[model samples]
Target: MNLHETTVVLVAAKTATLAFGSALTYLSYSAFRRTDSRALRALTIGIALLTLGVLLGGVLHQFADITLEASVSVQSVFTAVGFAVMTYSLFVDIIDEPDRTRSGARTGD
Candidate 1:
């Protein structure tokens, strides 16, 4: 549609993204707390970074007099870093406990 309509749609979409991202970050943080696992902690941080990127981008565009492209660039940087951290978390070892079999039996290393 027109420019104003498009801007409104973008704002709404960004707000929704922020809301959903916040919920996801909270869930990840809760999971990390329950397990006390380093990987889970990293995952939580990654999720937070992603959510923060959206927030920062919005603020920059709306209040910092930054160009839309620049704001999006900042968001992209955070997203990339967040994904990298998540990937690293996958390679991290689990808690320092004996390995468990599928049936929940502890196995010797």
Candidate 2:
């Protein structure tokens, strides 16, 4: 693709990622209010990080061709880390919630 096209694609990707991140943040906040669970909070944070990674990936792709040599290597690294952490937190949150609820029920009984 042409440089212009590539740049456009990168910009679009970045915008979309950022938007998604914002939405996730909002949803997480809502969930937090409704559930007051740490797992939900962690999951929300992870979603935010994932969104950030997407944003950084887009930026890195766009900067790859610029004359200014604006490298996205660091951003890419952070993105990967963020994705990993977020994914892990999300998984933990998913798995832990059921156990927490079950324990609470057993205690009540």
Candidate 3:
């Protein structure tokens, strides 16, 4: 009910969201490596949602003036990086798929 309690709740929620996003990103990457269709799709969606969640959480925390401690910031940065990588992987996969592009080229190639 108090400001501190509210901030603590938000921080905990953000942490959990970031952890789940990281797990999804990792699983998706693993699936892509193994050439699993389900895993790849899961990863794409998971990473996308995770990215959104991270952005939203960061914004919310900033607006609320909540300090997520130094460790959380580190974890958040890593999570953001992971999300970026996964997103890039998904983009590449989509662009590289023969059905998705003409001559399988990603422009200017």
Candidate 4:
């Protein structure tokens, strides 16, 4: 199809994918909260940040006349920060002593 049409299709696909990812992450966050998993809370935040960033960029592009380069830069920051949060969270463990049972040991998660 035409360039404009192709761009629209691509953007729609990207938004759908991001939305789906965000939904999954939010579900994970809820699950983590149920068990009060401290280490994994940061993972939820990271996912949220990335999701919001992607959505913000998409909305801006579709509605506003902002430059493409500026939009990319703005969204990149969110993605970077999200990854950084996830890295820090995963690197730091909160368990002082491992809780185990006779059955398969659970992660307390």
Give Cα-based local distance difference scores for all models: 0.87, 0.68, 0.64, 0.77
Encode model 4's per-residue lDDT on 1-109: one tens digit a residue: 9999998897987778697868968886997889777657878888888887787777777678777777777788999998998887665453433453435557567
> What value does the lDDT take at residue 43 in candidate 1?
85
Ranking by TM-score: 1, 4, 2, 3
- TM-score-best of 1 and 3: 1
lDDT by residue for model 3 over 57-108, one digit each (tens)? 5765677676656435744665676566656655655565646664466775
Residue 68 displacement (Å), model 2: 8.1
Q: Which ten residues in a row have the lowest lDDT in candidate 1?
A: 93-102
Q: Superposing every Cα of model 2 onto the true structure, what RMSD results? A: 4.9
Candidate 1, 25-106: lDDT as tens digits:
8998899999998888888888888889999999999999999999999999999998998886765664343363446665
In order of appearance, the predictions have TM-scores of: 0.82, 0.61, 0.45, 0.75
Question: How many clashes would you count in candidate 2?
Answer: 0
Arrange candidates by lDDT, descending: 1, 4, 2, 3
Candidate 3: C-alpha RMSD to true structure equals 8.5
